[model samples]
Target: MSSLKFYNEEGAGQQNSDLYHYSQAVVLGDIVKCSGQGGWDPTGKLDANDVEGQVDLAFQNVNRVLQAAGLRGWEDVYSVRSYHVDMDASFEFVVDRFKKHCPDHRPIWTCIGVTRLGLPEMLIEIEVEAYAKKA
Candidate 1:
């Protein structure tokens, strides 16, 4: 059996988690499960004001979490789930960004429209599940 390992965000993530406790990601053997990441940077500030900027920063945060779990890059990602305040607007951008990042690999994806997210200013949130289960 693989034991659970927690990877708490180091800087602003740590501070943010103080409000609500959770890890940025977790590891169990060869699998890495990352938590929802918003457009906030290491300082816990909203780095991107628009949906396009937010989507870009959110992906960066997801990558940051993945690297923290010891994974190389997006090729290790097997699945993705995103939450958007306005699906009509965010849907296209998220898909395009996914293609840009995961160019070599195509992973399962799901998009959800929500009333809001953890942060009121957030436009989108990204979470992923990755494994060494590549064929």
Candidate 2:
């Protein structure tokens, strides 16, 4: 049996966990599931006007958690869930980001539209799950 473990790296990852009371990612067996990551930068800055940049930054944050476990980055990821404040407004940016990130193949993905996110300036949040292939 595999024990449950929490993953929280240094810098912004640790800060977010301390303030929010949640791990950046959780691991059980061979699966690593990350929390929803918003568009804010490492300095906690969010740009409301840049949808594409925000969405891309969200994925970057997701990758940070996955990489913390020494995984194969986004390539090891098999599932993704994104929350958007406005799907219609951010559809193109989201899809464009997917294409750029997963150019070789597509993973299981779900995009949800919500009224708001953790931060008012945050327009997109992304969550990802990766396989560790541990024995």
Candidate 3:
């Protein structure tokens, strides 16, 4: 039986991963699940007041975590869950970023609206799940 594999990319995902006791991504067998990532930059500072920038950064963060595990790219992503502070206004940017990342194929997507996230200034967060033939 294969054991679980946890990946924590340096300066990726939430800065409080250690305090929260959660990894950036976990892999078991050929499935990889990543924690929700906000718009925080590599230095862990919130990228405030720019929803488009935040959306782009969030996608980058997700990809960074997936790459850390040496798994398939966005093409292998089976599902994605995106949380937005204001869906009415931010939805377009979200779709644009998603398409930019996974241009060839459209994966299952879920969008949610929330009043707040891990931080007060966080505008967007995204989580992804991918499957591969081999890890």
* Each prediction's whole-model lDDT (CA): 0.83, 0.84, 0.84
Please estimate how well model 1 matches the true structure, expressed as its whole-model Cα lDDT: 0.83
Instruction: Give the total clashing residue pairs for model 1.
Output: 0
Candidate 1 local lDDT, 1-60, one digit each (tens)? 257887765766667767788788888778899999988877878843589888888898
lDDT of 2: 0.84
Candidate 1, residue 27: Cα displacement in angstroms equals 0.8
The C-alpha stretches of model 1 lying farther than 4 A from their native spots are 132-135
Rank the models by TM-score, top first.
2, 3, 1
Candidate 3 Cα RMSD (Å): 2.0
Backbone clashes, each candidate = 0, 0, 0
Query: Judged by lDDT, which candidate is best?
Result: 2
